[model samples]
Target: MDPVDIGLWGVPLAILAGAIRVSTPFLFVSLGECLTERSGRINLGLEGTLIFGAMSGYAIAYETGSPFLGVAAAALAGVVFGLFHGWVCKFKGVNDIAIGIALMLLGTGLAFFFGKPYIQPVAPKLPSISLGGWSDVPQVQAALQVNVLFLFGAVLAVFLWWMFRATRVGLVIRVVGDSSDAARAMGLNADRVRLLSTAAGGAFAGIAGAYLSLYYPGSWNEGVSSGQGLMAVALVIFARWNPINCFWAALLFGGAGALGPALQSVGVSEGYYLFFAAPYVLTLGLLIATSSPERAMQGAPAELSITK
Candidate 1:
């Protein structure tokens, strides 16, 4: 009946909207991670990659006046980082997990150093589809304003799912991930497969970065990532390395992430911190839930460090 009551009632709608908006980055990052894990390698440095891509993408967009160009730059930056990580991990003595962590720090450091200059610039945003156009209510319309990246991610999920089941490249990647020895016996180059997968994964993460700065929360800042990249690792596990499942898992995490803001919109500011904590809570919960009795991931690549 009152403003507070009205706000409270609108919370659900707000959360739904927030979920769609916030889920884009998660979807992209998780998909990228899905790709990497599918290749039997763990890249802990993706957090760094996310940050660097965010910075690089934002800077490029600001300079080029083309948000799409920023996306391209972010993907390129991600490829470079991915290639670096993949190459270093090829040595017999190299540890993928350790290298991943190192890369995380390196990526974050580089992002901060180079991102300082572009923090204040206003970059163009990519177009969005008005999914809620059928609704006359502003809230409904706003809630349904889907970003193009979200659509692309949905398509990617299906494509990857199909790729894994129907394509030679996918088969080779799965073979290399499942058993390096078996792959070698089959004359498949496991290391090469992993390198390319990691690079592709990095490219995915970069696109995610572009989504963040070019669209929602559109800005170049040191704290732009907020662990979306890291949290994606758990999301991938929850999805059991299934590409299609990754999309659903990302949406779930996105809804959880939106919990805090949704409550705030309804004047329910009490325990706001707890609401904001929902995403982290969901991340930990997913990890615990997805772990097997053997303590290995349910559908992880056998060659992954966690399984080893």
Candidate 2:
């Protein structure tokens, strides 16, 4: 209750709050990428999908006064993008990576273009659940005001982990990722599996987009994503394609991302800007540590293009 105590705990408390907030998008996007990569494909275009979803969701929510509807629209848009990417990559000589890059550009460009009008409008915002009622400190209360989507993303990570380890659908996706030939021999359609996984992944990204516009910063803008969509791909690698690990990795990235602002909140302005780079630095470090050919191959799906 003391002012000194509040000052002492402010930075860490803010970081904790920021981690919960910032990490939600990362959690959703990374989990989506995890599902896609598990089926032997990657979606760098999720960056585009993310922004587009943000734009679309904001536009719809502004018009309809319903944030949930906006989220659904975003998910549908992501599905369309995913399907297009999947369809294009089905050609024998086509490269999924190249297509992903193109899609990323396409998605971003479209979002910026169509998003121009919605920038000034205020949309319905998502509600948060306060878990810090027992605490008398304002910082504790602020940090504990959790969003519904973050909880959903956490539940999703657990559900994905369970599905991959126990379900028949998961078995099919894994078999297809490991070896197309083996999948074909067992009478599974590898292309269909990958296509669906990619689509589902896009839906996840779209939902993340909605969360951005409807919650957190809670608005539409060109700079809303800040490359978090693309960065999530690296998060997927860091997590080694494990859904549960993806959840933890996202929180780490989130906390790192929150460091700069958290420092600034506590009057540490001298070098606080440098802390903003923590997430990117962590990404590079993780990639370097994990990129050994043997180590990469050990955790990556057999048919994943990066591993090859």
Candidate 3:
């Protein structure tokens, strides 16, 4: 069989691998957003947080020679960003969406400026678990090599889902998100709760950034996030703020994202670029289909700014 013909068969294999690899960032970011939105806060600035995390993670990993440290640094940075965003939005007349946009610009700017020095440096990559060892085909083996972060993300989704369903912390967040006045009546600090949730969400976005720079594409670049952070908000909505559903939705987006490159690799060049836009198109479609004000509002937290 011709090499290209063989490559055709590899398309599905490539997509399978790409889905696992690509979906990871989405999973982390969506999970984080899920937490934030669950608390009735919307953070549009996660995109900036994502870029800054990639830059900081790469620089730290390059300096420390430890990818794990880089991940830690990214998480810390995310926490700071999230906290600031939460604090500022707590003020009356301040819009969360506008603040989020500003933060996104700030994060992206800082990342590009600080990350310039690390562009040429090679940082250590995170390790992957070889699940395809049983397969004789190189494609199968490559496709089966899953990253540790992906597994962690999967576990996190389950944990978040369970937390929401069963935990005291989750209950408090839900209450604040549902009605701040009610939360205050219950003696809960609604503002503090949102601040913490937003911070946690930022940490997740940071980890997602670390995964991009230190694992998959494995480098510091301005385009590292490719808007995955921003898109995650939509993913969270598509999942109806359910963590487990976010996991599945992320994988679906990842597969859609991989379709173009996978097809191009198999010599299918016609309109392959469109495949790159598949995730975004799907997001729009999902929103259109599910976005009747009453329907969208049903699952949305009563205190959420978007729904309001």
Candidate 2, pairs of clashing residues:
none
The TM-score that candidate 3 achieves is: 0.96
| Residue clash pairs of candidate 1 | none
Q: How many backbone clashes does candidate 3 have?
A: 0
Q: What's the lDDT for residue 107 in model 2?
A: 96
Compose the digit string of candidate 3's lDDT tens values, residues 206-256: 999999999989999999998999899888888999999999999999998
Residue-by-residue lDDT tens digits, candidate 1, 109-224: 99999888898878888888998777667777777888898999999999999999999999999999999999999999889999999999999999999888889888888888
| Candidate 1 regions with alpha-carbon error over 4 angstroms | 1-9, 294-296
**Clashes (N, CA, C under 3 Å) per candidate:** 0, 0, 0
TM-score of 1: 0.96
Runs with alpha carbons beyond 4 Å of true place in candidate 2: 1-5
For residue 208, give model 1's deviation from the true position in Å. 0.8
Q: TM-score of every model?
A: 0.96, 0.97, 0.96
As a whole number from 0 to 100, the lDDT of residue 199 in candidate 3 is: 100
The C-alpha RMSD in Å for every predicted model, in order, reads: 2.2, 1.5, 1.9
Q: Give the per-residue lDDT of model 2 (tens digit) for 1-308.
A: 55335775788898899999999999999999999999999889999999999999999999999999999999999999999998888889888999999999999999999999999989999889999999887778879999999999999999999999999999999998889999999999899999999999999999999999999899999999989998998899888899999999999999999999998888889887789789989988988988887676567788888877
